[model samples]
Target chain A: MGETFKANVIDHFNFWVAVVLMMIGLYAMITKNNLIKKLIGMSIFQTAIILFYVSAGVKDGATIPILEHHAAETEQVEAGEHVEGHPVANHEAHAINPDDYSNPLPHVLMLTAIVVGVATLGVALAVTQVIYKNYGTLEEDEILAKIKAAENDG
Target chain B: MIWQFDIIILIFLVITAVISLRVKDLLAASMVFGTYSFLICLLWAGMGAVDVAFTEATVGAGISAVILIATVYNTRRDSSD
Candidate 1:
């Protein structure tokens, strides 16, 4: 049982770390009363998720997704010889093996996610500013209290 | 799998996170949050996700922290709660 636990720990260490970070972020978001701090926690949570996804796409000793061309085929071209039908000269003619590269799909998807996160954060901060201007405090409880008091006055 | 380095970085990340949450000063929290984002960027880069790391560095560490600091500047820096 100990050996199995050790193996799992070794194999999935990144995931475990990511989860711990996520929990920390969740704790901050839930417990913090300050609006900006909550935003910080939200960013932390988003990044932890991005790390988890990026780590998931990793393979042992895998290179980047960029396709590589064989040097031998390129060498002949440098020798002042145009080799007809040479796959190296025509990048589209060569089919790359998917196994050679780290999975790029996650990176692509997370790119959009990161942009969206920034946009959301901007909007949230803008709203927080508005709240501060209206209520004169950024604390959730204080803002709620102000709203309730105003409602009673009306 | 280079687990040792990852463990060390993650430990620092958690420490920064906890510290950010515990600190009463909002500006200090924002700085600590930037450190957290940077650590995650390193973690992503180490895991072979250069593009994601780049995005994290630019968005999480750069823009988000800056915007938060600006907002903090515009409001109260201390939390009453």
Candidate 2:
């Protein structure tokens, strides 16, 4: 049991680190009073999740998702040799091994997530600025207090 | 992938995340968060996700940080907690 645990820790170090980062971000988001701080924490949390997905897609000895064009094949095509079709077609004839390239699905998904995170950040910051404009402060508690006072007055 | 490099970058990532959250200066924290993004970009490149790294470098570290700094400048610069 001890040996397996050690091996797992060594093998999945990235996952463990990602988990720690996620927790740190969560803590900041939950505890920080400043609106900007909470946004920063949200950014960290988003990045941590991206890290986890990218790490999951990693394969040992795998190159990037892009397929390498062999010089010989390109030369043949350049020499007016009638190529059957695109490079992927030729790869299919040769039986391309999926393991040779890192998984692209996770990367693509994370790309969308990153864009969404940035958009959310922008919108949240805009809202935060408007809040500061109205409340004269960015602290959550201060804003709450102001709202309470306004309610009592009303 | 080089495990040693991965370990180092991940450690830096966590440290930057914590520091960004802990810092009193909001601007400094935003800068630290940018650093965290760049580190994660490096991690992605090392993991053979070059395109993702490029996107992260341009969007996450560059555009996002710039907007964050802009927001910080427009608002308060210090954090109470």
Candidate 3:
């Protein structure tokens, strides 16, 4: 029983860390008052999701997705045994197995996500600067208060 | 499982997160946030996601931090909400 618990911990530890990061980011986004801190929280939240994806793509003992030239040669040698010494016959026949390397799809998608995140952070911070320029404050409530005062005056 | 290293990184992440959020100074918080992003990059790289780590490091740690510090530069140093 104890062994199974330990195994579960080992296997899913990365997931737990991602979850914790997500929660921390969420908490900050909800509770923090400063605009920059909220942006930081949003960035943290994004990174946690990226971490979850990258960790999910990990496989034990898996190499990078790029295929080596020798892989086909080695595979042909292993497959040639059953063909009665016909060593080079199926050189171009067998396809590379998918299990030998980590998945690249998630990595590709996260590349886009990270770019979007940076862009969004930049835009959001620019907006924060604008808010401060107009209202002389970055706090959400203070901005609301200024808006209300302008409304009342106008 | 290399669980020890992962746990240690996670601990640092949590510590930085709490400190970054709770700190009073916006500049200090932004710096701590950059540290958090960097730690996340390390965690991703250690998990064999080199591409993701690269993106995180460049965007999260580098570009995002610069943009944030610039925003802080244009705004008040203290939050009053």
Say which candidate scores most in lDDT.
Answer: 2
Task: Please state the Cα-based DockQ of model 2 relative to the true two-chain complex.
Answer: 0.86
Local lDDT at B78 for model 3: 79
Model 2: per-residue Cα lDDT over A73-152, one tens digit each: 66555444345544444534454578988999999999999999999999999999999999999999999999999999
Q: Estimate each model's TM-score.
A: 0.85, 0.89, 0.86
Q: Write the per-residue lDDT of candidate 3 for residues A1-154, one digit (tens) a residue.
A: 9889878876787787788889988988998877888887888888788878877887877777778898778776667675776556565556686776888888888889999989998889888888888888888887788899999999
- Model 3, runs deviating above 4 Å: A72-97
Misplaced by over 4 Å in model 1 are A69-97
Which runs of model 2 end up more than 4 angstroms from their true locations?
A1-6, A71-94
- Residue pairs with backbone atoms closer than 3 Å in model 2 (clashes): none
Q: Rank the candidates by DockQ, best first.
A: 2, 1, 3
Poorest 10 consecutive residues by lDDT, candidate 2 chain A: A79-88
- Error of model 3, residue B53, in angstroms: 1.4
Model 3 CA RMSD to the hidden true structure, in angstroms: 3.6
| Residue A148, model 3, lDDT | 96
